[model samples]
Target chain A: AQSVTQPDIHITVSEGASLELRCNYSYGATPYLFWYVQSPGQGLQLLLKYFSGDTLVQGIKGFEAEFKRSQSSFNLRKPSVHWSDAAEYFCAVVGAGGTSYGKLTFGQGTILTVHP
Target chain B: EPEVTQTPSHQVTQMGQEVILRCVPISNHLYFYWYRQILGQKVEFLVSFYNNEISEKSEIFDDQFSVERPDGSNFTLKIRSTKLEDSAMYFCATNRQFADTQYFGPGTRLTVL
Candidate 1:
């Protein structure tokens, strides 16, 4: 079965501190991974996605994620945390095979809190 | 910078009532999808629509759930019989093509009593 797991339920970081949110996936083949953020009362916004090639992919809002195939992990990272960056982050994966067709499997999201 | 858009930011209905949720995807997008997030739960995929038909659906998309692209600019999801468990945030998403990143709309919050 294809699934995504966000190990952390909640994470807090002081402003200017670095942040890392863990994500792990279970899939039979090379996976298409994505990171999305949902602010309160807002839609899920795509931060970044990894389809192929580079292991480290840069995203919007100074966010980046690295896809480690051997580890089945695609952890998201940020050099510095901002109070505005505090939101719910979700990790999702497309199913294996041709034309996955937007049927994304999402992980239980991690709530990020950045304290100023 | 086109984004998917959904109507009626919030809806309140009684159980057993039928409800239709509407969405207008980015004009050029070719794939459309519906997902629901129950309060405090993970977002779950409902169905994917492409080329006027459903391409895929999850187990949660039961017989009571149906999706349609009635015309050129609008897509819709209809729940035949709403239940208390049906209360959730329904999001509409669109992508330009297969395997492309999908853009989501501000979700519609459905509250069933």
Candidate 2:
């Protein structure tokens, strides 16, 4: 089975401040990781995804996440937070093979709040 | 860019009634999926469809839940009997074959009373 854990339930940061949201996953095979954002009452918007290659992967809206196999983490990072960046962030892992194909296990989620 | 689309932004139904949610996946995508998020929970995968049949599904997708690709671009999910617990925002997503990124629709808020 695959699972994701987002340690932070809520994070508040002032505009222009740096932000980091932690995500950890448990998977036996190569983990296909992704980050998604959802505003209130909206569907998920893909932030980025990591299948393989560079540990550092950049996403839309100036967000990026680093896949750290040693720690089983794929934490999202942003150098400057904008007010519009506030939303709920989720980290998900896709199952490797067999019946698990195309299945995604998501984290509880972390709500990001950007302040002025 | 083409994106996934779902109809009926909101639907209200009685507890014992059946409900159908529709989605129109991207024209060239080969995989379609349904997911739901309760008011305060994480997004949960319901089922996935490919080649006119279900390729995968989660435990939440039980006998009461069913999916179909009746046409080239339309994918639909039907819940036999609605439960209050089924109230959630349902989302439709699509991705190209062998692709890791899935694009999601605006979502339909299903409210069962």
**Best candidate, DockQ:** 1
Fnat for each model: 0.82, 0.67
Q: Compose the digit string of candidate 1's lDDT tens values, residues A4-30.
A: 999999999999999999999998887
Runs off by more than 4 Å, candidate 1: A96-100
Strongest candidate by lDDT: 1
Worst 10 residues of 1 chain B by lDDT: B94-103
lDDT of 2 by residue, A17-52 (tens): 999999999988888999999999888999999999
| Interface C-alpha RMSD per candidate, 1 decimal | 1.4, 1.5
The DockQ figures for the candidates are 0.78, 0.71
Candidate 1 lDDT, B1-113, residue by residue in tens: 77789998999999999999999999999999999999999999999998899999989999999999888898999999999999999999998878678899999999999
Residue pairs that clash (backbone atoms under 3 angstroms), model 2: none
